[model samples]
Target: MAEEKDAAEALVTDLQKKITDAFDVFDHESNKTVDVREIGTIIRSLGCCPTEGELHEMLAEMEEEEPTGYIRFDKFLPTMTKVLLERRYRPISDDIILRAFEVLDENKKGYLTRDELVKYMTEEGEPFTQEEMEEMISAAVDPDKNIVPYKDYAAMMVIDD
Candidate 1:
């Protein structure tokens, strides 16, 4: 009861500290504010993945608060807390990620060669852009085998909270 409340409050404090520290790095001039234009990077640095449209929407709220177009720490903190609590950007479950890879593996090979994944990611369904494919492959492929061992990759991809 009381302990749970204290734990939740402590978590919020930690999140606020992290966001403030990241915001300071980009603040460069120590203005205690950041350009609204860089809000996406700020959010990403804090491990939040809001889409472009979502960023636009969030920035709209900041626009109302700071007519000067820079976001202060006070304005940034509550907005970030709301976004985190909503959990809209939570990582996809590992089970679902593994299932997706299994579908691509086709022959139950338990892995995807680099070339095969490139083709599937770039040509199938809502395709990955060239940059997205390159990034995923670089991080996910086995250098020796030249393949993506997706079972292991899923563990890397799913960042729990």
Candidate 2:
């Protein structure tokens, strides 16, 4: 039990690091706060295409307040990793992935469109090629694509016990 607890804590720490790294990549100015656009860019980088609406939905999950429309660096980054890993690592369940998708989809829409993906990328100041955005959307939402909806996008993700 003690070992398991240690492992879990370690996983969380590693996940924090990943979030930090990802933020570094997305936060061009390095001031910390990630605006809606930055969030969109990061999603695109992760190989997922989100519609503008969907990008808003994902940001909603991390929003600490309203109007300001910003995700504080400390809260948003850590929570994203925690929520993402919890969903991915549960081998016995798709509940986590399903729920996350639901959240990102916002409007409870079943799928995200290319326009949304472009919106997110543009906001981040890092735009994706049409081909790249399409490929990412396919990975995340296309029933035919299987890159996501896995235990983790990759094994490098930190998992909780």
Candidate 3:
């Protein structure tokens, strides 16, 4: 237990340093924070192509904690940690995928219907086009059930393939 706790703390420190360095590159104003517009580029630099709505969502989430329109390095730590983790660990586990599905499954439904996915993806930040949503659903949804199960969603994101 001690070893595990130590490792976790070390990992958090490493992530914090990495995030600070990444944000520092864009902190030209020396204010230790980046404007909302620069967030997309910073995230992209870290290798995540977040959609416009996703960026907005991230900002809104950050705002909830700090109530500031700008993104301070400390406040953006969680977003940076997620991006770093996703990059370092590709082909996330089924459990992680299921958790993500749960976020979109507002009604606590075990499976995601086409309309539910469409609404979740379109109603929020950047609206996904019909074609894009269909493609995403078709790729993951089971043909027989016409719904996306946790397993199928995990399969769609398998990095090994």
Name the 10 consecutive residues with the lowest summed lDDT in model 1: 83-92
TM-score of each: 0.72, 0.48, 0.47
Residue-by-residue lDDT tens digits, candidate 1, 1-161:
99999999998888878878888887967978888767878887777766667778888876654378688777888888877766555557889999999998889999999999898887877666677788899999999999999999988987665
Residue runs of model 1 more than 4 Å from their true location after superposition = 1-9, 33-38, 51-53, 63-74, 124-130
Predictions ranked by lDDT, top down?
1, 3, 2
lDDT of each: 0.82, 0.59, 0.73
In lDDT terms, how accurate is model 3? 0.73
In candidate 3 the C-alpha lDDT for residue 139 amounts to: 84
Candidate 1, residue 54: how far the Cα is off, in Å? 3.3
The list of candidate 3 runs beyond 4 A from truth reads 64-69, 82-161
Better of 2 and 3 by lDDT: 3
What is residue 161's positional error in candidate 1, in angstroms? Answer: 3.7
- Tens digits of per-residue lDDT, candidate 3, 1-161, equal 99999998898788778677878988989888887777876776655656666667877866546565578776788867876766632345667877888887778877888667777788876677787787888787788987777555775664442
